[model samples]
Target: MSSIHPLSMASPYIRIAHDFHTEENMRIGPTRIVDHALHYFKEGDGVYTVGNRPTTIKAGSLFLIRPGVPFSFSASPGTRFHMYNLHFDLIEQEDSAAITFPYPKQGEPQRVPLPCCLPDEQEMPVSGLPSSVPLVETATYEQLFFRILQRFGQPNTIALLQSKSAMLELLALLLRQTENQHASSTSDGTYETHLSHAVAFIQSRLHEPISLDDIAKAAQMSKSYLLKCFRNIYRLSPIKFVMKQRIERAKCELLYTSKPIKTIAGETGFDSIHSFYHTFQREVGTSPGAYRALAHSTALQQEEPE
Candidate 1:
């Protein structure tokens, strides 16, 4: 699995202002929300439309509604909608002028960004948050939602902190689940499961000059079969994939460390500094020194006072 940056150590002041479990046959407007919400359906069914996408919300379903997105909920004709709902915010400090919150009424759809890693399409509509409203169904997840509902009944700091911790845990689980789903969607089940071993082997040995035979043996498949599966799944030869991984590692070293260009090249498995310079320019559209300079300047600018 790819590594995601950890959340900031700054304590996010998350408050659960309202909580309820209701079984009502009703329809809510196509209005936008100003705060993030988590809804876990326990009974009945409904249709929720977020932006332009319509999703079926049935019993055992969980929905994360991002702020500023227009959404509506309508119960099925004969069934009552019963769900546990919680509305909350990740409060920002007063001095944090760089942070902006979304207000749809003011014609701004962007909300305060959350410190998470997610794909572009999955990002919050206009908030720049790392994740969008995702719907998931699982018994274990349902139990977590139930625990949050129970915690809401106790109005105390301990309970509030507990609820916040639980919500963060849930968010992490959802993000990981979504990542796994995306990985699976890119290939067939057999290829997805088997190719993972090869990918891991390559990633782990990126500092070494690994060959196709090595990867095939690690993946427990013949070279020809491995090549076919890899091409079908990743559209790249195993060697190309290894090269890409090496480049990516080199980029990280360049941006995050003050290591010399020659040292970085050697660490990333390049045969010579000349080859590293050529490959880095070809892959990144910049020389190693230029990329490092640009990254440092950007970092410094971001750290500057407003």
Candidate 2:
């Protein structure tokens, strides 16, 4: 699993939430869903079919089904099953809570959601998230699932808010798992050597226009492979990584030097003063001059004896 930075969105609006303890010989749809869904198998002996892919359900199998995907559930011969099922919208709409989906139908066509990704300005390079995550410690996840189910099974505003908060926490936990996996992958000697080379190249070229090709060449890999490496390790593209390095260098120059804003901008490889100001404001939440002034004020206050 690759690392994924929390992308732009508020807490999800949960639509349907339930804990299902199945009866004997049970089988359910080939249902096409219109909202995102999470089916956490707490203790199940079953097979979950999503699109054309099918996976066996274990004690801690989590199926993350995006909107418009066809899925079905079947019990493993004579075995009863138990799962926590949740349907939600990635972002809330005014009428989200009022909407309800139709019953599952067979042979429902699949519909794809707009791609979710990081690197705000870039086109979506990430195609799809993992369909299933086999959880290691089931207790923590069970607690979250219980909280979400409990909160959403209410009739008040506070309950709604609490459910949404718990949903976000669950998503964060899943992302942290993937991030830890990616971190371990990066610890491999070859990946570390290439990543170090790539970082050194970016550090050296913070004052020059560094391109994706340049970074790939430095890392001795193809551009596509380099992108995969960066996405896995840093959860962003190589060019975005370079831009970040440039901004960091600019911040250091602003705080410690008397250079003019334009000089600093040019030295940090920004195309123009306007571009520098825009990127600086977006990344640092302040204009270059304002940040420098604030840093200067802090330094002066610190230098004064208490």
Best by lDDT: 2
Off by over 4 Å in 2: 1-7, 102-128, 186-306
- State the C-alpha lDDT per candidate: 0.63, 0.71
> TM-score of each candidate?
0.46, 0.51
- Give the TM-score (vs. native) of candidate 1: 0.46
Residues 1-306, model 2: lDDT tens digits: 966444447558787888888887679888766677888876767898978989998766888876655789888888877888888777776656555752334575433342232221123223223667634334446656666765665666666786888788777666655443445354456765777678767766778888888899999989998898788766779898788767867776776579999999999899899999999999989999999898667445544544
Summarize candidate 1's per-residue lDDT along 1-306 as a digit string, tens digits: 944433333244344433345556778768765566666666778887777778887765666666566778888886676666655554434522333332345555444554322223434322222323333324335445544554553546666576667666665656554544354444456655567678767766767789999999888888998888767655678888788778877876776578999999998889899999999999889999998898667445544444
Say which candidate scores most in TM-score: 2
Q: After superposition, how far is residue 190 of candidate 2 from its true place, in Å?
A: 15
Clash count in backbone of candidate 1: 3
